[model samples]
Target: MLTHPTLNQLHALGLHGMAKAFVDIQASGDAASLGHAEWLALLLEREASLRHDKRLSARLRYAKLRQQACVEDIDYRTPRGLDRALFAQLAEGSWIDAHANLLICGPAGVGKSWLASALGNKACRDNRTVLYQRVPRLFSELALARGDGRHQRLLRALGRVDLLILDDWGLEPLDAAARHDLLEILEDRYGRRSTIVTSQLPVDQWHALIGDPTYADAVLDRLVHNAHRLELSGESLRRVRAQQAARTA
Candidate 1:
């Protein structure tokens, strides 16, 4: 019974999954058929699965993926010049294990952000922490952090994430403060954390986009040199989707 002291104890100990399984097994009268080892294994497996789902849910919530997207949802039929074999390799998440970065650069609307978000979602599903932030908004937050004296804390948090997706990179020009903040972030995350940068600008132009030559060198040094590149091409996927919708309509 829910009123039982043992059930209460299980709840108190935060073993809700096990407690629920116990109740279900008892109600189903499986205790007579299941050996002790079998019952124990069932309970433990339920608890483990529940815990994994909870962790994944928390990570996805914190990730702010915007589209609730996943890798399988990607539209490979759009002829985006994407390399299926290479993306297949990336889907395995070995790049993250190597602490390498990803550069997704292309014109607007080709699903750069979507691809990055898919990768981020995959990272979350794999039990790795991920954060998705647009570069412009992230810079604004960093500036605010500096004003509120939480700049270092923000950098530390970014450093701890298993994968960081900086979407909409090169959307705006970076001033001195933003340049410095970007450099600081890259420096902290360099060689230890993996990042996925989705930018409309090519990597070659990132230098001018960052403004200061020195900061550009430092930031790109930490980010670009060792990174894997995925340059999305062809017309924007949004246009393609819209055309498809119109035809259906």
Candidate 2:
């Protein structure tokens, strides 16, 4: 067999994975023992794996998650009131498929943002599109978009993602423009896509934070209903870790 010619053809066809697999198999001592069918199957499998990895890489890059967290790395032993069973179910991503929302509420340093990022990471792994944005920054960007006439285009992009993660919600009360923009984004995504929100404030206070009775009701109606809640309460993890380091030193 003309190995170099075969390799050239594979490379020309952009089958990089298959070409690499072919080289590896050629180097193996048992290459002659495999049947033709087995060799073809191995090449196809490598090609599929390579494509999957490329797709996942693109999804993660687009997500721009706030934290590099994964569900597998979650600290269940931290006593932060994270429900293992519920999170495990959520990790399976059925809720995302159903277009439901997830609310992670806790005080500062209780891993609210981290948990939301972990879920976003999981969604990317599940082959779902995701976008992460801090609430304050998102509003600022939206305001800028409005001024530059990119407002509707930006909102449409936000709405199209499979999972939109809003981290650090309720950092401050929303002004009129922010309130209206938020409603627009949520309304666009209301029944078509899932959202994960992380907040230092509890859900009940969200209405007040939104600031207008009419907009508040409309926003909450889209977000709070059909949402799963994770209420975490504990001492700050940062404080605990620093104390442990001090004791070790």
Candidate 3:
């Protein structure tokens, strides 16, 4: 058993995970005990795991989440009106598989964006493609893309993602172009993809935010209908944390 030649062959064939596992098992003196079949199985498992990890890393990078949050780290004790059972069900990702929508509404600093990001993170972990964009910034980018000839391409990319997180929604009223763009984006995704929207304004106020009765009706029809709603309420978590820190200091 010439180990160097075998390792070189594995590396040359791009079996990096198996190659590293071989080295580790050889160093651990496990190679002498394990049969050839067992050794092959272990190597294959390591390679699959490595590939899965790489894919997850790429998905997370593509997600571009606004916060480093996870479902496991969610503060259930924070006195917000989060429904644990419903959220648990949501975390299983059935809603996403069904191409449904999630709406999270709360005042500023109430963790609306954070909760949305957590769901986005979970979707990435579940091997689903996700894209995170703040509504205002996304509209701005869409406007610029129109001038740069990337408008349709960008929309197509947005449409293709498995889950799209639109954070900070209704931060500013949409202008005519923005309103049209919103409808276009939503219409493209309607019943075909899942979307998570976080907003300071309630769903009732969304129509006014869009500014045009026609486009507003179209946008809300696509977004509000068949969407799961989570309305959070409490004092700002930021302020509470700052007060606690000051007292401790």
Candidate 4:
């Protein structure tokens, strides 16, 4: 019979999940039908599952995904010019472990951000720390961090995330400060963490967009060297979807 002392001990050891399972089993008298080994296994399994769930929830919360998209929920049927094989490979998350980056480029409203968010969501589910922020917003936040004298702190946070998704790249011009800030962020994560960038401009135009050849060289050197490029080609998905909806209505 399970007793109060046993439950208290389980809770003390930070096995609250198991402790609750034990209490439930005792109340139901279900443990009486199981052998000692089986009962212990059941308790341990419950504890493991509970911890896994809690950890995943925490990762997702911290991810701050813009679209709440998942790899499984991707609209592969929408003709967004994505390579299914490449996406399938990325879903395995091996590139993350290898410290590789992903560069996704496409026109506006073509699901570039959604794909990046989906990849980020998958990273969170894989128990990896992730952050999703627009490139403009990231620069703004960095500026604020500098104002508050927490610039290094913010950069460190960005550096330590297992996967960083920067959306809307090339949508806005970057000043000298923004370029240097971006370089610092990338320099910290280079060869240590993975990054996912979604840009409306082609890779060839990035240097010109950065507006500084030297900084562009330094930044792209770290990013493109060990990156997997996904050059998406398609029309505005939003417009197409709207047309389809109108026809249905």
Best by TM-score: 3
Error of 4 at 35 (Å): 1.0
Clashing pairs in 2: none
lDDT of 4 at 193: 97
Which 10 residues in a row give candidate 2 its minimum summed lDDT? 23-32
- Candidate 4, lDDT over the whole model: 0.91
lDDT of 3 by residue, 118-229 (tens): 9999999999999999888999999999999999999999999999999999888889989888888899999999999999899999988889998988999999998999
Q: Clash number for every model?
A: 0, 0, 0, 0
In the range 1-249, model 2's lDDT, one tens digit per residue, is 788999999999999999999999999966899999999999999999999999999999999998999999998999899999999999999999899999999989989988999999999999999999999999999989988999989999999999999999999999999999889889999989999999989999999999999999999999999999999999999899999999999
Q: Per-residue lDDT for 124 in model 3?
A: 96
**Which regions of candidate 1 fall more than 4 Å away from where they truly are?**
1-3
Instruction: Sort the predicted structures by TM-score, highest score first.
Output: 3, 2, 1, 4
Which prediction has more favorable TM-score, 3 or 4? Answer: 3
Model 2 error, position 126 (Å): 0.8
Model 4, residue 74: what's the lDDT?
79
Model 2 segments more than 4 A misplaced: none
TM-score of candidate 3 against the unseen true structure: 0.98
Candidate 1, residue 160: Cα displacement in angstroms equals 1.7
How good is model 2 by TM-score? 0.97
